[model samples]
Target: MAKYLMLKHYRGAPAAVNNVMMDQWTQDEISAHIQYMNDFADRLKEAGEFVDAQALAPEGTWVQYGGEGRPPVTDGPFAETKDLIAGWMVIDVDSYDRALELAGELSAAPGAGGRPIHEWLELRPFMGEAHTITE
Candidate 1:
């Protein structure tokens, strides 16, 4: 099986059908959303396809090493940044199509009013370390 990364973006993607900000959701709606996400991950684990999943906090800094003896330089989690990855799920599935199917399911997560969000998710395949005939 191969591992694939399914990325959920907060911005820089097609807008969701229920495009309301999460902060605007009611307490009940937020609870339902969290429940749905937990259920999805549980189902994936039951199917033996789940590798890992995580959500990132909005507040984070971008840092890079300045030099051999210098301190690392840090920059803002700038408001002007175009792309922000909200979360990701790593799945070890049988084929690329299977990865797509799982990503589709995740994209169907509940949004405002307990309806499917129809969000867009980015799917990327992992590179293998094995030597191939082409090499």
Candidate 2:
């Protein structure tokens, strides 16, 4: 089986629904949204295709090692960056097509209003030394 990475992307979800912003939703609505996400993850687990998943913290920076006696340089999570990754899921699948299908399903995860986020996901195949070959 080949390993694939399912990357999650969101423009600015947290800002979209802050405490004040999400105040527009009732408690029942929030509960339903949470339930939908739990259901979706459960479905993946039952399918045996869920290898691992994780959500990332938003703060980060880029650091560069200094050459010779120069001081190391550090940059930041640029505010102009539009393609912010929210999370990722790693899965082992038989083919690229299957990986793509899984990514599609993940992108349909429920967001506000029980509607699909339809967020953009980057699907990448992992490459490593081959251990075996078959004819």
The Cα local distance difference test for each model comes to: 0.91, 0.73
Count of backbone clashes for each model? 0, 0
Report clash pairs, candidate 2: none
Given candidate 1, what's the lDDT at residue 57?
89
Model 1 lDDT tens row, 46-116: 99999999999878899999999999999997999989989999999999999988999988888888888
**RMSD of model 2, in Å?**
4.6
Error of 2 at 16 (Å): 14
What ranges in model 1 sit over 4 Å off? 131-135
lDDT of 2: 0.73
Candidate 1, clashing residue pairs? none
Candidate 2 has its poorest 10 consecutive residues by lDDT at 13-22
Worst 10 residues of 1 by lDDT: 126-135
What does candidate 2's lDDT look like per residue over 42-112, in tens digits? 87778787778888887778789989899999998798877678788888887889999988877675555
